[model samples]
Target: MCAYAGNQRLAGVRPRRPGPPPPLDPDAPIPDDPGPLLPDDPDDLPPAPHEPSPYTEPAPETPETEPEPV
Candidate 1:
């Protein structure tokens, strides 16, 4: 009896199954999908910082603190 290569790896493989083979998953990152993929409403999206994020911008003024003399 000859051992066929197809027999070694086909467990749970159904015979006479009609349709295209399962699609392969792509390992590469998609160019169109630059990530930080947002959820529809996971609420996990980080809240925007209330203040300006950049240090180059002047610090926001606050009423509680007096401005120090330079």
Candidate 2:
């Protein structure tokens, strides 16, 4: 039981044969395609002037100070 020492299944040494299951990623995105994946390249289309979202955190400036005479 000493093919080279320690734990190949306690040194009986026959556990290294698992290599043939990985070749399906040719650009990967076709699980079955029933027809709605639309991006044939109008510049990949998704940016036509919807610009109003700078992460929105600008509403905390309330120090105008002029209401003490009523």
Candidate 3:
């Protein structure tokens, strides 16, 4: 108990070590830095859907093109 917090800081009933940090709201609204991840920003948002990476090699089956006119 650290001697009852040093007798409550010599009877001053002390308990406040946090005062001096509230003056930076100059229209505070500028927090958006996320445009540089995939292929160096090629529309950075198509590479985070896991659960199918057996050494990654299973996306090649497109051979059915035969749609006649109406």
Candidate 4:
């Protein structure tokens, strides 16, 4: 009755330290066709739903034509 609550018969034999269970490299190259997880059936599909380019007008600062005065 004096071993820090861990002397109860050594807790039913606890000692497992085994290794070596990982070795399988048989040429590994299996990937002939793994595409399309889930996305391609919107019925006739033509409206994509991105709508953000009504002509995209936001870059009109042109004023660099001072190189022809040489």
Candidate 5:
């Protein structure tokens, strides 16, 4: 006999049945009003500070006219 011949077949295996559904809550009916997730007033947010632009021109370079003796 093969080494795995005595093992149980998995073809008929299935997950166990789940328990009874949770009890329903009658008070969870749809709310009349849904409020915003964040504050409605502009004052509630912090002001963003200004940042320097990366596209600005760089400073001019000074020319070196003299060559050192070898």
Candidate 6:
């Protein structure tokens, strides 16, 4: 079996460390509530055009076939 390049590391090699987070602003304005974008009243909305769904109606029953004699 062959060894990967990442598996072989030099004796004194240390992993890099992450820096500290930046300070926040105290005087920033509080976010306002984003209200419903759609109209509250149902009458305001346009009526949906009707289209018959294929799956809405039950499939037609198939006639039973007579069994074959042995």
For this target, which candidate reaches the highest TM-score against the unseen true structure?
A: 6
Off by over 4 Å in 3: 1-10, 25-32, 36-51, 56-70
TM-score of each: 0.19, 0.22, 0.25, 0.27, 0.26, 0.33
**TM-score of decoy 3:** 0.25
CA shift of 29, model 1, Å: 14
**lDDT per residue as tens, model 4, 11-50:** 4555567898889789988878978766589653454457
lDDT of 5 by residue, 1-70 (tens): 3333356545655547999999989888886777777788966755444643455654458765788889
Q: Please, what are the lDDT tens digits per residue for candidate 6 over residues 1-70?
A: 2333467855666666888877878998889989898899976766565744444774468966879999
Better of 5 and 6 by TM-score: 6
Lowest lDDT 10-mer window, candidate 2?
Answer: 4-13
Error of 1 at 33 (Å): 7.3
Candidate 1 segments whose C-alpha is farther than 4 A from its true place: 1-36, 51-70
TM-score computed on alpha carbons, candidate 2: 0.22
Clashing pairs in 4: none
lDDT of 2 by residue, 1-70 (tens): 4555653355345757889999888998767767768788866666556543455655656866788987
Off by over 4 Å in 6: 1-4, 29-32, 36-70
Each model's lDDT: 0.61, 0.65, 0.65, 0.61, 0.63, 0.69
